[model samples]
Target: MVKQWWAALIAASSVLAGGEWQNCFNGKNLNGWTVKVTGFETGQNPGNLFRVENGLLTVSYSDFPNNSFKDEFGHIFINRPFTNYHFKCEYRFLGDQFPGGPKWAHTNSGVMLSGQAPETMEKEQKFPTSLEFQFLAQNESGTRTTGSICTPGTYVDVNGKTIKQHVIKSRGTALPAGEWVQAEAIFKNGKVSHIINGKTVIEYSNPKFDDGTPLTYGWISLQAESHPIQFRNIQIKELD
Candidate 1:
């Protein structure tokens, strides 16, 4: 009986892990994504803000003139829009936050899901209307969760009620600065799951725009929000 039970469990797990995953970051260049920044034109990475180095897709600000951030909130968006899929990536904070960045942006970044295309954003748009899988590492003095959700120009249903708040905390794992963390998002239909280090931290259903329109599909984006961060092994598998 134990042998039969183990076989069944493996079969069920395979169903949840359906379809083959393809690499979203090519590791050599930003070939399959578009870069958008608040001040610069779309696709213009003035400071090499987004680049691949040492086999990792890095969001670096070292080239910024005068070493100033300039409030150039940026997003490197996946080339295509996805509807039902499982996306995962590993990220780690590398160094200090850029000067002149938001005070709250210390060791902060995120992955944007259900987001509008880069082409559709206004020239000065800071963030797209989407659900953000907010990533944060503990500062030198305090603790912060790593897999929370932030809604910008959107809303999600949690606990069977619609929430319009901009930020919602998740019971995600907490880690010290400079430690690599794994974050995953599973989106099927209108439901979404945020996971950190293999634990499901937050779950939301029926994600839609604040204007009452349902958001069933959209592009994925990686944030470059005034922090030096590195992401690698970004892959996505389609879900039926």
Candidate 2:
């Protein structure tokens, strides 16, 4: 179960804690990012699903036919991996769901944590082995929590107990639609915490692949699961 536990831990405390913040999203282009769409080879952008517009790294669906998404999930990942760091970003749901995604993905998009390399994933793989720090937007109708955790081909532990199930809810309330919500993740001391706005929403430790390989380091990626979302201010700080 321990692929050596990544050999270390990474975390994001307060950005105010301040090391040096690297702008993962330069706000101009996807220069250092890699695209991986389901059923497509790595580095392929089948439908222009990911792009930069108006200085924001965006996930758009204008190319898909009306009511014809066909479950074409995708991700754009940083070119390299990281360990013992803090990650932060701003996101807002836009447009409508692509009509083919699961109901739970209606207002969902996320930044993947401790994810497998983009190049290693199978062409038809829906998602990589990673912990998802999901951002759920509020529809003003019912209860939903932002900054929740979802394991896709991965798993984590909480409170010193083994939690193999997927979809762990967070304490943070659902943020309003069309508004930018601040989301962050801190991987430190062998534990990880999800922060929404200014509060810690969910926390866990011991991330591992479904096959039980320890995830000590991984690439940071943004999800495009049939929903249009905007991600900006993507930054990271490696802890000393």
Clash totals for all candidate models: 0, 10
The digit string of per-residue lDDT tens for model 2 on 118-231 reads: 887889898887889988888767698899899987888988887888998899999777999999899875689999988998889998787776776677899998889998
The TM-score values for the models, in the order shown, are 0.90, 0.89
Estimate every model's Cα lDDT from 0 to 1: 0.85, 0.83
Candidate 1 residue spans exceeding 4 A from truth: 1-18
Judged by whole-model lDDT over C-alpha atoms, candidate 2 comes out at 0.83
Error of 2 at 131 (Å): 0.6
Highest lDDT scorer: 1
